[model samples]
Target: MSTIDRRTLLIATGALACVGSAHGHGEPKHPNTGAPVAKEQQPWGIAGEARRATRTVDLRMLDSMRFVPDRLAVKLGQTLRLRIRNTGAVLHELVIGTPAALDEHAALMLRFPDMQHDEPWMAHVPPGKTGEIVWTFNRAGEFAFACLIAGHYQAGMAGRISVRAA
Candidate 1:
């Protein structure tokens, strides 16, 4: 997965506070291959070893364009499985990352408009289908998980992840 460190996020946000065009932010590129990366993962968290889930939270994507419970609390280092279901009529995806990266990617989506991408931190689901994500909250900070499906995000398809110290 393409992960963005704190420094990159700060610089990007500091430049694009208004969520304007991502000029000078450089093309979103894959970290390893130097190839263009799409919707890169922010440095907030890593791909978890989800062999087993300590707990499970079922978050449903509704036609209202929102997650059932918009806020989740997890202790740092807690690995949990997210059972995601799409109850809407369109495609939806749950993407976990820093708010900065999410906003940047959302802006990018507005530009490309048809970019389809996925990563370990993401779960794509279609209407009436269910998807799953195993995530470990390794860091004790505020992160986010949102549906980056073009207008879905702007329509309020998002949630907050609060990882308190374990």
Candidate 2:
């Protein structure tokens, strides 16, 4: 055979050897490429599994304002997963507190020049992004959640979370 043919044959043989070794290791097979799939790329194949394990909640922010759901009733002593999405132009936060606690917290937050709300339990979510929070409420009471970012709470970004005994 010519030198070019020999070089091509050697390259093909090397590729086939790599494929055979990968197969022996029980590697994932690429659909169209017919090659061993990388670990990171395997997520594409198990995307549904990953999505099934996560719980998501959509939230929106607009003009430095946050519009959240009015009421959220959860079971006491149960872990709750929350996903807050900011679909607004400005930054926002999700603050959790009791109604009385929020009242005091909101007052305290206003004292700081940069602080918008007073609640200690807060999640800051930037524009066009989502933030996740996992919380367990042991007490059954009327708890409030709001965005204490300056005027966000006043702009109606607050909601009530009623935890009832399960």
Of the candidates shown, which would achieve the greatest TM-score relative to the real structure?
Answer: 1
lDDT of 2 by residue, 4-52 (tens): 4345334533554455332211122122343331321110011112223
State each model's CA lDDT, in order: 0.71, 0.52
Candidate 1 lDDT (Cα, 0 to 1): 0.71
Report the CA-based lDDT of candidate 2 relative to the real structure.
0.52
Model 1, runs deviating above 4 Å: 1-42
- lDDT of each residue in 1-166, candidate 1, tens digit only: 1344546655544544553432221123123343332433346656655574698999999989899888899988788889998898877778887777788777776775655454567787778878877777777888888887678889988899999987
Worst 10 residues of 1 by lDDT: 21-30
Residue pairs with clashing backbones, model 1: 29-37, 30-37
How large is the C-alpha RMSD of every model relative to the true structure? 8.2, 22.0
* Sliding window of 10 residues with minimal summed lDDT for model 2: 39-48
- Clashing pairs for predicted structure model 2, backbone only: 61-88, 105-118, 109-117, 109-118, 116-150
